[model samples]
Target: MQSAFEKSISPLGLSFRIWGITQLVFSTLVTALLMQVDVLPDITVVYYVPLISAFLGLPAWLILRIALGLLASSRLNVRSRLDRLRWVIVVLGCGYGLAAGLVLVVLWQQSVTGFLTGFALLNAAFFIGCITQHSVIMAYFHVKPHPTAEARPTPAAIHQEQNRTLKKSYMEQTNKVLYKAIITALLILLLLIPSVFIQNLVQERKSRQAEVVHEVSSRWAAGQTLSGFYLYLPYVVSGTTDSGKPYRIEKQLIVLPEEANVQSVMEPEVRPRSIYKVLLYKSRNVFRGQFRIAPQGDFNLSLVKWQDARLCLNISDIKGIEEKVLVKLQDQQYEMQPGTPETGFGNSGLSLPLASVAEVINGPVSFESVLRLKGSEQLHFLPLAGNSIFTISSPWPSPSFDGSYLPGTREVSDSGFQAKWSFSKANLPFNTYLSDTKFDAGKFGFGITMVQPADQYAKTERSVKYAILVIGLTFSLFFIMEQILKKPVHPVQYVLIGLALTIFYTLLLSISEFLFFDWAYLIAATATIVLITWYVRGHFKSFRTAALLGAVITMLYGFIFVLVRLEDTALLIGSIGLFLILGLAMYGSRKVNWYGNEQQQDQPRLASTE
Candidate 1:
């Protein structure tokens, strides 16, 4: 048998001159392939440009030459060197193939075919060159010398030498694996640099949508928030000044209702602006309350002018009030007009003077009004009475109950939604009557927003936030597959996968502008899954391996999509899901042998798709 110290050629020893000739031949083949495709219309691109790109490999060639030279001197033994050599060849082929695929996507419609043909040729050339180089290296495998060893083991010393070899091999394999894992982790972090831009893109798109909504809402009415039907009574008070002179001053007493209830029926409309849709609504509202006309304890009853009392209602957006507002007090009708009455409303509101003192002088009298208003986004009601109850119904299924309080009773489904709120003196933060103070009515109000369910941008943004999880788990999966198949996947391949994941967000954002968010998510996820699945299949040449990866990718995307749509329980569910993912990853890697510890490699063996 030949000694291990015998002279042999490594694939790495394929020399600068021979490699250049092979590269040129490959480039020429690529050019020829491009020439056959009809996509080349211009004479220069047809004849000259593609030929030039072949020679363009000189730069990459020189760089890879320096890298291989450095790797030749590494501490890795013969088997390790051979394994790494095969890995490099695999990467070379896959790198070109993936580049070809990406170019096919990014290329213009006009010249895509010819360009893709050239790239396909490049990929095939690399693949054939890699396989031929592997075969040559394997031909001299028995006689290949360890870079450090000076002599081959004699048959009598083989058993003793085997133990030493195993120890050394174990150390080499451990270091190699540890180093690769570290590089993969770092690559995961590096790939996140691009995901930052993806986040910015998501935000930029969301902001654009916001701008569209604002533009539409500017022409349409803004959100509506309704406050009290205040009973404003102006009285003349007779008081003595510091100089002891008698003076008469007009004093205002504000009285709130004992109980108030509002009923609103909202008809939602979606207004499209460019690529965005703004939610707007026309609401028919009825306000009913009962009031006690009792003045302040300090004030004389004779000074109170009940007839001149103005009943005012504060509407956050008066422009939204569509029609005439009519008030019915004690079964008498009174029309309200915009702007302040007597002691000015101090806000944008409507006011109406009582028909007569007889309307409320007897005792507590019930007051009613019908208001038809147009609004956008949301509607709110302030609890400005001792007891307040609000009932609102809409055909909109996705209503967000926002602000300080939630609806006590609510019904929501695909068909429609109805919500009712009840607030008593204990629940309200304000007093029933305003003696001489200004209260911010909006403070304790509760309302509902006509939220577009599963807002595409919002979901995309949430998905972007989980980029690390997607990329990290995917890289881990690929790494695990490498151990299982005993074939090393390159860092660049992992980067491409990360890039594909990031691109999925952009796809979702763009598509969801026209279609529903769920459909857009499904489409984007499918496209990305198909693409990555195809690329993975090209690498391993096994349908089962590619399908395994595709299934995992699908599950990851599906899980993220679910997390995005679940607003209320996202945090809890995400935490649980991540824990489970960690468990599954651990389970997947449980039996994976990091090093060929138990099994013996009689020779330096390298696996090949061929």
Candidate 2:
């Protein structure tokens, strides 16, 4: 009689290997197609955020195929009845696989739901086909009759048979352990594919949000900056030529403020454009400074034309000025005009005629101004003084202090925020004279930006980044439960569960816009947990098992939430969490004799048949 190993190359084994290869090839093509789905919509900038996790499906399907091939080889060696029911299930899975592949071809990128359904179906076919093949193999072995004992064998034949049986047993045991591990890994990787798409969706939404912000900012005033209080001193030089003819030349002398103080109070408001909101503000600003020209030996003071002097202040946007501005020079008041008398400054500003204060040129001159302006988003200032002290207060809760200089002191609360910036001449690169027309005032500028604390799209993107870990742990939990209960879960059911998890991100993103991120996350996570738990309860018919699954999922979501909130230390926290989870997994599966369990599960059925 032939040994089991010699009989292993049966037609059924060949067919099973062929099916495995076919499934692997088909899944590889499908995975490649799914990767192309990341092609973004037509926009000025396209971000090819690769859905690399989707590629994991290929290896997962391949692993399942390998498991099925081994199972089939083991079964082919055993003499058994052909189970028609198991054959029917395998045929059905094959049909599903073909139908899913057709669907992918028909609706490549036309519909996201179609693509997801097709992807899930292909995965399900591979998974279900493998499990069904194993079931058929087990049934064949269990129902097979042992050889009659009437014909006694020779001693040498018996010894050879015993050795063959031991080898077969060892191979079967190894295959069983490998089968369970491969299935668990496949399910985890299959779940990860949808998460990649979900992350891509989050990125798309964020890009749209940015477009909306740009549109709104274009209509309203963009960020504004104020750099000013330069003293415009016009002077005339009179001299006698070689022929004793007198000549006069006109010149403008730009003087920086010796000491400056600025105070601003802003009332901010939110304007909603469609679903997006923008920040706008009206500010009441006060400026006070002194400008003095130290007596120099370079020019004769007798020929100075101090009467042509003017006081000027530069502003970024004239449209943002809501009310009239007035400048006070000592005891005299002058109404501000639209343009600066000195055109060489290359700035748009308001000027006050200071030709009347010619007597003040001999000493330090004090000036004051009151400005009422309306702007949007951000407000900035330049340090154009030898000594400058600037203070800004707003009713907006969130403020981003940005620019070349940060606020020396700041306070933030639910009510509002206050900030102060003080700078001296030593802090600036230029001296009292700013002759470079191309000098960027923004370099020395500091500003407060009114912004939202938590953006929904951003948080959603962050959560999606943790998809692999979440899916792996969740799938492992299910696999462990299956091993303990000796109850198998269908591949289709795993796909459904994964789909539900992917939808959680979509629900969270949609709900966050209307509610706070924390509340949205709570609602989305609760809904998903309840759904999956209820489904598992129906499948297992055990409340305790379902509750345990739900608890694990809840913990994962909570852990992810903490990681997202702790942005600065997310990497450290994530590493620690992963290590702890690995320890738990290791401890949980420490005593699980995967092969022993298979033997215990199969032996009783075979014995009963005998």
Candidate 3:
């Protein structure tokens, strides 16, 4: 006589292992396919796959029940017979119930009012009907075996009848148990597959997220570069040259690094040094000799918009010509007449001295002049010659300047002193100048501080809230539904509830795109609550219960909205909300009896004397 375990094990003989391996392989292949498929190409098909598959589980469950029935019949005689009849009833009832439930769901999806109400009502009705049918069938089977009859029989007859009945009854019960077990296992496994897949998918998504961050950082580092320019202008009219008629003199320079040994620098150095000769001519109309920066070539420049910039030159070797120089800026031209301060070139950007001195070849009088220009304005800088060397300038409709030019300052300092002077925007037409102009100025002299973008904080806040709201709402709805509905609600039901929750986020994003977040949340949350409340009321028997659930949902929405709005406290708010949900669920489920139907009433007992 072989043992039961040995017999069972012998029959499975590597088949179970093979099946497990095949399942893993198939699941992996499907995962890969799902990842590779472009959802945009066939979104409808992809979206419906899980939905269709959920309903498919019902049929799989039925088939497994049928197979279990056959298997039980060959072994347990009495239990098998009882089970077969039980399944006949259960299978038929469940089949009708499932069919009706699915139809109602479809109707609800297509039409919210009439069909949806009927649909939800139908599911509730079917659930009750199926349970009633099961109870009736079970009672009938138990009572049917023993019928009212009067019979006086011999010992042999009695014994034989008892044996037969006992065997039949035993087999019937065993078969029912086996069939139920198999059906349950099948349903559970079907649900389990998706859960497992989702877990793996979540892990993969996190990994991809990390990779994306790394990729972005790498790109930013690769694109980093450096470019800008400097200039200086200077001149002298020392009592005119001998053959001079009030002779005027001027010198301009495209300043470069004073050091000639340039090769001692790193290769691919974004910052380079260059110099240009001063192209100068002399005239009473100072503009005649001044070289136009032309807002071109490896340089950035800006001037007041809508106003002409008057280039004035008053080169005087003031205090420190050897070290630095001094230049006084006075308005030589006017825009709307110099009636008030605003009528003049006004204040804008920076104004400093452009000081230079004659540097005779191999002469000690040789001096390099540094011209500092500054202003605050919006402008654009683009690579000139379509290369790395950029030029900054303003477009049309910009400000213009007059009497704005400060004549070149000349100074002589033996020890060389750092020229310190005042530059004010008090001379510009408007208080607000283009940052573009300032940026160019920074490129030329002032170094720009690399910092976070202005909108980064707000954008990050929006994205975090958006993602959390969708994910939290989705999980919350399904979790609540599962809590309220004791019986096994299919994953399809969970998915639908989740979809409704996710739609809230979509609505929020759309409305917030046009309106404020507060208004958007109000509209979206109200709509979601109304629709879900109406559906849930129909799904359950009591409107009050549905309203209560709706209230909880609304509260959750408010909580999420708070999370979205309060940037500083979002984490704390979310954490507390999560805790509250968990505590409520824990407290609610404390009294639940897991072994039997919750709807079943408790048995009453009569008091007994001690």
Candidate 4:
């Protein structure tokens, strides 16, 4: 056999570079493959954006490696120098690739617990990649020099030395794997115990919060002040003005209800709180200069404002109408507006609130009226009412909309206008509707009105889902960045970030119970962003990087604000953001080269001073 003095190349040098190139190519291919997968018909295309983001780093990273490789070849000739930089880049690229794969797998096909399990598997892959790179670097440096006494080693001896290096690398890799297995097991056990407890606590808190909200809503509706008004006009100035003298409108509205019950009527709150009240007036049809009350045509009656519901009239037909006409308290006056010749209520004459109205937080109510014009001329009130204007019960008496109130199959009843709605704790509005429902008095126009709670729980659930999706997408984008840039991100950092985002919902729910949702969101988002930004600075070594991430986090939180506020258009906005991010990444990576180290080698240039 030849002596051990002969020179030889390290097998590690060949294998390590090959392995690095393979990993880069493999990662890039996987990312492209994942992005190209067709989304199932039933699944929303937006849901795939996170998975796409997780994979986006692979191609960019590979191109970076290629650039590093070209730089190294042109400048560095020594294996030791090139290998050191190569190991760092290789390990970083592999670690990022494995991490992104794990994130995609977790998001696409697993529960929260299962996703964490996937993360542990990902960590194992990372450790394996790290050991592979480390071993090659260590083996290259570990060779013992031959003794000078042995003269010079032959080529055969050099071959034997290369075999030794290979064996040592194998041993080192095996030890690394064994250590990783032991640590992984221990970590799994430790995390599992706490994870179970934490998850249970979260579930319990959600249950308790939902229950409290229901109870609060029930009490609020029950405690609302109940009050309304009733009117009775016994005496009236039923008259017609002179021909040119702007119809001398004179009348005395004797508050009949006031005289009937002086004690109750004079009560501070009960005495017609509204400044406007209903009034009754009648005019007779008569010939010119003749004083004969004739019920020939329609009569004019209207409401006027004094301190209470009163009357105002404009008599246009005094030619065949008498100067004086009799008036009667024919119906309950919710609100009455008498029509004139100038503005005649088409066909039918005056509208009178004839039915007794009762206010209830129960089912909605429907009210009907007849604009009677003398001998029974009737116009059927169409299904023209909406919202709180009328409570049209479906299935005759049941308080529901869809259970019995189908669109085409409506049944007209004595109840005038038809309006349908559902009412319960589950039906209360959560976000924008809260302001509309809570603040609007729900009394307007010329229809009967009702109030009922909407689907509050459904509203809350939708908001929460979108919030979760936004945070999930944000995390995915960050994960992709970490992979492409080979940024160091610890598990603890991920946990803290997730916790910061998760707390946003809790904050929103708690603050919104008493304060307005807008204000609540502002306080919660600002606090969470500050906490996360501070924590991110700890994760990243540089303050500039931390501030950059802080800005991203701030923008993400603001993005969620738009999602929550613009419920109808949130999905569209989120899609546009995804497209923009993809475009940005593509543009940034256009000139990058693969098959190289992460850090470029500094080229030595001749200087005049030297």
CA RMSD, predictions in order: 13.3, 9.3, 20.7, 21.4
Count clashing residue pairs per candidate: 0, 0, 59, 39
The stretch of ten residues in a row with the least summed lDDT in candidate 2 is 44-53
Q: In candidate 2, residue 183 scores what lDDT? A: 54
Clash pairs detected, candidate 1 = none
How many backbone collisions does model 3 have? 59
The C-alpha TM-scores of every prediction are 0.66, 0.71, 0.35, 0.34
In model 1, which range of ten residues has the least summed lDDT?
Answer: 601-610
The alpha-carbon lDDT assigned to residue 209 of candidate 2 equals 76
- Residue-by-residue lDDT tens digits, candidate 2, 1-610: 4345535644456345435644554455455545546432443222221233225334544543454445445645442122333333345444554456466557455444444445454655455444546644554344345687687787777767776666567556656555566555656655655675777777777788778877776666566788768876656777899999999876555678889999999998788877777778889899999877674433433545655556778777777888788888776777888887544443687876666666665667888888988788789888888998999999889999998888999999999999999988888887665534455666677788888887888888888777767776777788777767767787677778878888898899888878899999999999999999999999999999899889989999999999988878999999999899889888987766565534544432221111
Model 2, global lDDT: 0.70
Best by TM-score: 2
lDDT of 3 by residue, 24-78 (tens): 3333333333444222345455455445434543453455345443544354444
Against the reference, the lDDT scores of all candidates come to 0.73, 0.70, 0.36, 0.38
lDDT of 3 at 44: 50
Candidate 2, which segments miss by more than 4 Å at Cα? 1-170, 232-253, 295-310, 339-347, 352-363, 597-610
Model 4: runs farther than 4 Å from truth? 1-460, 467-471, 480-487, 588-610
In angstroms, the error of model 2 at 319 is: 2.5
- Can you tell me which runs of candidate 3 are displaced by over 4 Å? 1-492, 597-610
